[model samples]
Target: MRKFNVFIVLFTLFSLFISEKAKGFEQAGIYSAKIETNQQQQRIYGTVTDQNGETLPFVTVLVKGTNIGTTTDENGIYEINVPGNVTLIFSYMGFKDYEISTDGKTKLDVVLLESTVRLGEVVVTGYNTVERKHLASSIESVDMERVVSRPIIKLQEAFAGTVPGVTMLQGSTLPGDVPASISIRGISTLQNAEPLVIIDGMEQPLTDVDPNQVKSINILKDAAAASMYGSRGANGVIIIETHRGTTGQFKVNVNSWFALQNPLNLPKFVNSADFMRLRNEAYSIQGQPLLYTDADIQSAQEGKTPNTDWVKEIIERPATSYNTTASISGGGGVGTFNLMLGYIEENGLNKIEGSDKFSARFNTNINIADRFILLADFYAHRLKVDRLRRNNDGHGLYQIAWRMNPTQGIYYENTDIPNHYMLHNDMNPVAFINEGGTWNYMYDK
Candidate 1:
């Protein structure tokens, strides 16, 4: 009986202890719920703009002392959920960081100021890279964004009307021909005035470069700017730098454009009747017999004569061209890579003349031992050009076409050789173009 009494007393004490613990837990739960109810989450919205009142996209907006963050959209708008009395941070490239306190308010708009110091901008010269402000010589730099904006057949064509004191004179419309005679600061020398072109420290023709892979192009106009090249800097210097991968996430870019070309401001040619009258007048003035008889002139006036528009026959209408480029770039802990592929097809005003180019480039930078960096660049391209067969005298078909008589027909009624058209004065422009066969020149680099 004594043992039973002791057991009952212990049981009663244990029950009382359990009840006190349950009450404490209930009070703690109520306190936590009240705290959570007081800390209400409010939606914050704002726009980020630059000092010039321009919307700044891709700006990073973050809540202070927390992992919550968001980026501004293309329209510079952002929304976030955060507690009161918290601060928001805004940051972007080339701009000063901005911070605003919520202070129990929901909406906050910010205008970031531009960084005053621009010494970080670097320009690549042939020998080395220097800060743009520190460079003492006259150098003009063009970035890839500007270079690839236009539909250009050759790299040299990108300089048209863009570079100061530079003139690009296109002498021929033939495909794959050297684009234009590039003159910097007018004629710098009496002979051989072509500027020296350097691509990644190697002398190369601008035509061989793929504009899609270019990172930047710098032109050294003054002797001091190009003195490193010695005698090659007499005329001027063009330094081209290809793109290299950066240390970040992977990126892909695709660019394409289609264009049509037609002859601009072409002179109007005389009709058959007018041509005959002019020929007769020229013959009479030169004390020679009339080339066309009265019957022929009458027949031409009556639209019975076969008068072909030679220019129209030789020149193709609405020549079409297209260019496409795709590039992939990425970087990791120790290495980075960039690969680009490009294709271009340009048809000339002449049916038989056209050019196609295929190009590939790979650039890589490997960090060795966290100290040394190894950079490798590989580029290759194949260019195929189709042109007319030139005469033995080395005159191009277009040149001969200009000298041919407008009154002649493209073909003859009878010929000894099968599938061969008649020749006029040892040359027939149309027949030569149609029957001379195809001439293709291919170059790989």
Candidate 2:
């Protein structure tokens, strides 16, 4: 029995030794054998630790010379059998690459630096690269990395508070008509001060271009900077560069976001009493009958009929807005082509009224004959505003509530109120509201 027990123990020890040897054999393959025979054998073992000293899993370990590679396990430990004189390469995206040599060491730890190309690198100017050394021209280049870092749906939203000297006023909330007024470097011309926008080498209206596809936006301010654009540059010039394809296999990218757009600011109007007083003054000065009796005037004074804040009443509502884009880009040594499709849906700030906007853009670019290149882009947009009314006309919401008679019933035949005559064709404020007219205004002719 003692001899049998001793034999069993020996067998168990032999099995374990064989198992370990098998494992070693599996790790050291044909490549390991070649290196061993050449007297250039190396057994490199290392642990990849992050900045927090925690083991990094699946870290790639490569020997620079012979294509011998291995990956670290969950415990952040890796082993590579290579020739002793070869260098090992370690790399991970967003981290600097590390290279080391094997002289006899068996353990190593590497920490990587975070890559920030935009912050430290030079920015592209016109044709050359310029270190932002203040060329002095009121030029404000919106930080693309900062703005793009946040998952923003619209490109215009990127201009929120970054563009110095530029003002963005929220207009309507309608998807396409999200009433926004973009004024660059202030209003220089009374006639039409809005700047001319050139997107991807194509001159187009700002409203026609959706912000979802913009990669970067650079604003050229100051007369000297904009002079190159001629008359259209009087207001200023905004250059929008869209995203393009990168070199590699074909790739697909989808960018989508859902957001709620509500009124950021609503102009305050006079209270019923204050509103009534202003109207009565205009009536008396115009030699018109007292439109409101004490009671009728009181109703308006106490927030009754004829005194309702129509602008607030009609325009205060929440709306859902969103943008989505799908893009594919990739190519070979010749060049690359990037394609993108995008869409947006939104409601206006007006509670019950709104607008719908649909837009499509296509950009195609290629190297014509090596040194010379050509790019073609087209943008088309359609807008439809429901509950369309002249809210900004002289006799529109404001003047009607401010200068019209307060006591007079909203509508009465043979009314005794005076109408605006300073402008010959100026219609009565009441008629302008209940009845509608049109003004001849066209620019694209």
Candidate 3:
């Protein structure tokens, strides 16, 4: 009876101890699970700025060692949820990368500095990218942003007064004409002093290219810098780099402009009465009869119907021009793409002369197995120009007007030919300009 009682007491004590220990373990596990759930997630907020105290938009903020990331908004603010112990990375192009530990904090503000290493400032040469400081030659670079901000029709027009050692002699203000005669370093040779122009490793006229598509323009002003082209580089060299796609999220840009132009520094001409009187005096000195009758001179002085001001009749005022461009660019791990489209319409001071242009460009880069890169660039443009015939010569319509007798009628009542005007030298400026005097040029490339 004593042994049985002792065994029961011992067993009951063991049971109670085991039950209490198991309950303790269960409470500990529940507490551990609660702590883990709380630490698994955290809401973070931050702002990013540059060294200049300017807020940086579109900056990439990423969680380190994870696929979770978000971009800063236009206001340079970001919000993300991440693990408490993880690190946050802030990155931007042309700027240094920055990192910070969460350290149980929920807000982080960062400022990134521009990269300082001069070796990374690359200028595209003919064959490769050479750093600006390392090049052992004279070179000048023009920022594309400044060039494109100006409202101009031709790409070459942007070079005027912007580039050093480049003289742009603009011959005429006519639409669709070559913008200027470019002379590099002041007339190196007597014949063909124009520089050799290279656009994206191809030789083509810069006038055909859209200013919006240009990324950079570099001028190699010395033999040392331009010797890569051998004999062709004697005049100098202009290397143009076009914009390309970058690996990032998709983006689109659109730009449009409208401009009005007026004719500048036009010659002042004498009235009909003064011109005729001067002519008669010269003719009289040479022992010749007077060209104008007494009635004609009286009519001219009184502002009669025969007196003509040819300059006012020919030129139009407030010439209008417009251009619009749009581009889309994006990329991924596999490849990148850039597409652009543009349209331009320009009217000259002379109503009969005008031009219109349409352009499209596609540029793509594809990575082949992380070893080879396939690059494809395609550009096409259509240009149409309507101009006046014989206006390109010295003895054109303007010259004809100087010698025309204003007393003559624009149209004769007894003329057999259709639309024939009665005039001196048998050449009427109005008749020539209005009748079959327009030339149309269409170009496709």
**Top candidate (lDDT):** 3
Pairs with steric clashes in candidate 1: none
Q: Considering every candidate listed, which one attains the maximal TM-score? A: 3
User: Per-residue CA lDDT of candidate 3, range 1-445, in tens?
Assistant: 2433443455456445644654465456445644876766678998999988899999987765443567899999999877566788787888887888888788889999887755337887777888777888888887677878889778878778888888899876677778688878898773478888998778888876888888888888888544698878878788997878765455566677889997678777777788788888999999999987777777789988466666666564677887777676755445667777777888876668788888888888887865687888898999999888857542477777766665656777676888767656767777767773788999999
Q: Tell me the TM-score of model 3.
A: 0.74
Better of 1 and 2 by TM-score: 1
lDDT of 2 by residue, 1-445 (tens): 2433443455456445644653464456545758666765577787887677777777666664333567778998888777656677676555566788776676766665555544524433334345556455556777877775665544556677888888877553334433566788776764486777777766766656555567767777787445667777878778777877543234556665666655556566666566556667889999997655677557765655544344444345566665555565643324556656555555545433344444556565565544555667755655554442555322254444444333333343354755422221342343434444333322220
At residue 111, what lDDT does model 2 achieve? 62
Q: What is the C-alpha lDDT profile of model 1 across 114-148, one tens digit per residue? A: 98757437877787788888988888876557668
* Model 3 CA deviation exceeding 4 Å by range: 1-58, 61-69, 72-90, 96-114, 118-121, 370-372, 392-395, 413-420
Against the reference, the lDDT scores of all candidates come to 0.75, 0.58, 0.75
What TM-score does candidate 1 get on C-alpha atoms?
0.71
Q: lDDT (0-100) at residue 439 of candidate 2? A: 30
Q: What ranges in model 1 sit over 4 Å off?
A: 1-92, 95-120, 189-191, 391-395, 413-420
